[model samples]
Target chain A: MISRTFRRRVWLVLCALALGLAPFPVSAQQSVYIPITGAKKLRLALPDFKIGSADPAANSLAQTFDGVLWNDLYQSGLVEMVSKSFYPLQQPGTPTDLGGGALAAWSAAPTTAQRLVFGNVVVGNGALQVEGYLYDLTQPNKPFVLGKRYTDQPTPAAARVIAHEFADAIIAALGGGPGIAESKIVFISDRTGHKEVWMMDYDGANQQQLTHLDAICYSPRLSPDGSKVAFMELSSAGSRIRVLDLLTHRYARFPRLGGTNATPAWSPDGSKLAFSSSRTGDMEIYTINANGTGLRRLTYSPGVDIAPVWNPKTGAQIAFESDRTGLPQIYVMDADGTNQQRLTMSGYAVSPSWSPNGEALAFSWRRTGGGEGNGGAYDIYIWYLANRNYLQLTHNGERNDFPSWAPDGRHLVFAVGENESWQLFTILADGTSPAKLTTAGSNTMPNWSWH
Target chain B: MSHSRLRYLCTVMGAFAVMIALAGCRHKPAPAPPTPPPAPAPAPTITLNADPTSIQAGQSSTLTWSSQNATKVELNGASVDLNGSQSVSPTESTDYEAVAYGANGQTASASAHVTVTQPPPPPAPAPAPQPSIQDLWNQNIKDAYFDFDKSNIRPDAQEALQADAEFLKQHPDVDFIIEGHCDERGSAEYNMGLGDRRANAVKDYLVQLGVDGSRIRTISYGKEKPFCTEHTEACWQKNRVGHLVLATPAQ
Candidate 1:
């Protein structure tokens, strides 16, 4: 008996050591928490983009660029935007305009913005050119923090693109991590008389249809690099996960695994996909290589286990939805399907989407009402993995579901039921700024890109 | 056949002799002839023809019909316009009759023959596509429903499975797939698991009822594709079911 107890003690120590030696870097952990807990936000002045040409089209392009940039900064939640009314009469249009007088005016007046963002847009021979700059108003000599020049076709879309690029650059320069301004959101839309996959900008611009299969599609998850989308498609044959190559506008060769394969989650490195399949006569979680090889079955429960989402930061663990405990709940397991840990105990929780930093999960939960059969309204909640604490992101008693994280890790896009029509909305992780993103027919199942 | 023909010939000859005798009697008449009553109105006459009277199987033909002096007309026991055409697709050779009626109960009738020829079997296509099993599955199979998130067969679900089993037992050669489905109230992924359980519950019950387990397959649609897209309880109940379809080999 003594030897047995001693062996048990050793085993426990080994587990503790294994947990302690996890590969999570300190810098990665800090990057995720700093934006959430950091209270002192830098106030930044965003003057309108100056129109370089007298052409009316250039004037519109400048307006469009300035509006997109301003919105991106506001959505980042990393900066305080100074009101335009507080701006000095002499706003900077370029780096040369950042003179002592302009800097002193911005730093001293009621407009005391700690930083400044200024840009200009010019239209020429079928091309739109944009010059953007970010200035540290408090720095000695007021050095330019970020300056970028972009050229694209002379269109509002191109203007928005340049603005997004500049906004992302500014966010990164401020040590806010990679910004999601230029990221895309893929979802299922039934606007074209069929449930087909669609894509749009992170801020709901340039909405475009991606698949014309004329068949029902669901749960679109964009790849980490924004080059492909994997989603469940229900054709006459059966339900299968199809990968669409966004760059080529073609279906990349994915093997047709039979027997109801669906809800594919891409690995962080884009090398493999984890999905739930019934190829062996039972629904189980399986991981397959992106090239359609290396198929590995991960879960063995007779109960249902599905909807796997990889940890974007480490890719070492996966959070998925399972009903093995007689009620649907959120569960996490190692990437190879070991070390299964249940994250939700008493509520009906599912669709566990890992935050970009891999430190927390956002999911839909009906936390009350007898688990099932009762009219329990689902709300989106974030469960922090470190402290095992959660923060509810939605309070309205509507059926909000399919919570997916933005690349910022501070915002989530989810579907809400309104007047029997489903729409997608993006809300901050702290339960603020609920912005509606879709107005068309029943847009749902939004998956924000990792980038 | 010869005997009947001889009898028919004798009857026709007798009819001719009687007609001749009547004509002779008319010439020699006048014993007690009264003033002739007003002649009765002529009966209606109808001409019916099926255009392209012969066609390959699955092809359609037009039945063009017209009637004269008719107050009412009927084609194949259905009332029709006096002078109209109808499209008819007959799987086999059929004779369509049209009857017209006039005043004083007078009537006339005609028939059009539409011979439907079986199409020539193509040598290269090998086997024709048949939707019989699919149609039979749709007609005979009944979906089994479960309570919210519960996979155990309820009393109502048991009755449905029993009826399904009766049909399956009679068709031993047929194979089918049980698709487990869920309502939109649950998470798409977890409902997948629930759906799978529901499907397997159905499969297990069928197997217990002496069905060949190998002949049955199961799939989980989860909540991705809801049969009923409403937010009410009735619609959600309709969405949670184990639907049956003919199990063609997966492609």
Candidate 2:
């Protein structure tokens, strides 16, 4: 009912409001880990890798590489990829292909990916060649954030490794730091008719046996530099804490404390080892030099005190499991044994692995008031050091335990179980995606390599 | 009646009665010439002797003992069965004495000195060939089983340990190691500690039974190895045990 002039005025006012509410200038930001205030995922694209060879083997490997790459990026919980349906009409297969308006077209319309990662693969002569390129389209002009290549035998195992390595590189480039792709997970496996130490890639590929002791070896803990592993080995004489030097491929003698010596944890500096020893007439926390000389007793409780993990950040404190209160719970104290404090009040909690940043602890927690027979009764929980509160990463009735924090602090490796067999699984700190890392040999006691 | 005649009659009667009393007192002709104290009981021959009354150092011999006409006997201040034999091992030449008591409160003794001669010097024990801990484990010691996640000695485990203690007592020169184990049901680090407790519990019990504390050491395997691979309770029970290993320098 208004006149033409008044209608035009209302329309102009509406237009001004819309223009004023526009988003921030995305072109100025160069980082992919943006908006650090909330639980937001980065918008990215992972197009199929381009094949460079005419070999039919190359064609099949490309498909596999692409599938693994997509899954790896998705499971990272940091990148939210645009659906393949919404990809740009023209897909660039390399960093050089970002020119000629392909980048402009990919950033427009239904394709609103702010970052792009593309690569090429070649398979011939029993070898596979893979190259990956990452770019931040927010800059619009800069094309190369990183370019990495991998060469290995043309097999499914090598293909998985290549995919995981590329994913790690891309994630490292985007997260403003490093990722866990190049890391290894050490665990106990019974595949050889005896419990032995075994290792696999971060993505659970190329599982190779490490220890041939043909005896029971569990609680595989890697040194801070990943040069050695300390584990519990069973012998007729008793359980002896043994160290295997990965660099020299030799077994090293652990100090014989006479009384039950088990659960060895290396200090942050790699010079001292903290473990639970009953040499003092009871289960007490003890520290010994790595070469096995100085024996210093820490905890004096009549009950058990074990599973000591050093805080990688300050190296001043250690998180451990203790039953001084009748139920095993997580406790923190100075590395020199002072200021002892309980981190968990109730429920049975053990196997505490401190976060790399010293900001949180991850462990298996269960409400110990009974009624836990059904499943999902035990779960992985992270206790934030600042607020003293916790977040449950797994729920329901499935038992999840032995959570070892990745060096990145954003992921954790834990043991997931059903009935008797247990397997290793990795998930983000936010509990978004869970990827299984092992399947053979009833594996458990997974320890992630330190960065 | 004259006084002299009455006195003569009284004297005659008194003389006859006195003679009768004298006859009663002297009935058996001077007690058969004083009977020589029944031949003095023959002085109780003890004959405390050892069969093969000599031994090489570190060897054993049987001590055979007997006594005659004795109510009680003792050897080296310890009561031994009369006329019995016992095996005795002496580290050095030692003298054994047997004292027997007669019925007359008198004692007699005999001594059998077993000569323990030194043999040729043996090889160095540390470097000498001996069974390894693993080998001794299979043949020498018994294993103590535990309840799930528990280190305290259970009833079944105690029965096995009693025999172990007895074996230890019998073999003083041999030491042992107690290995605590678990059944892959708990955290590895925690189980390591728990296994340690189990082994130590056995060691502690052995120590209580007069076994030298230093003779028994303990270690925890923490569910690292399983003797049985099945997932049944029986398999788990096999895993939760304190295995014994004889301690030798070679081991």
The TM-score leader among the candidates is 1
Clashing pairs in 2: A216-B224, A216-B225, A239-B220, A375-A397, A376-A396, A376-A397, A376-A398, A377-A397
- Give residue A14's lDDT in candidate 2 (0 to 100): 42
Give lDDT for model 2: 0.77
In candidate 2, the second chain superimposes onto the true chain B with a TM-score of 0.45
lDDT of 1 at A356: 80
Off by more than 4 A, model 1: A1-38, A95-100, A125-127, A140-143, A370-372, B1-142, B217-219, B223-230, B245-251
- Worst ten in a row by lDDT for model 2 chain A: A28-37
Per-residue error at A24 for model 2, in Å?
36
Clashing pairs in 1: A304-B193
- lDDT string for model 1 (B1-251, tens) is 69999999999999999999888876764678789999878889999999999998899999999999999999999999999999999999999999999977888999999999999877685576676877878888899988997898999999988988989999998888888888866655566667777888899999999889989877777776688787788998998899887877562
Error of 1 at A67 (Å): 0.8
Give fnat for candidate 1. 0.44
lDDT of 2 by residue, A292-382 (tens): 7898988888878988888888889988989787557889999999999987777678889888878788888875631111123678888
> Which residues of candidate 2, in runs, are more than 4 Å off?
A1-38, A55-57, A95-101, A108-110, A122-131, A137-165, A370-376, B1-184, B209-251
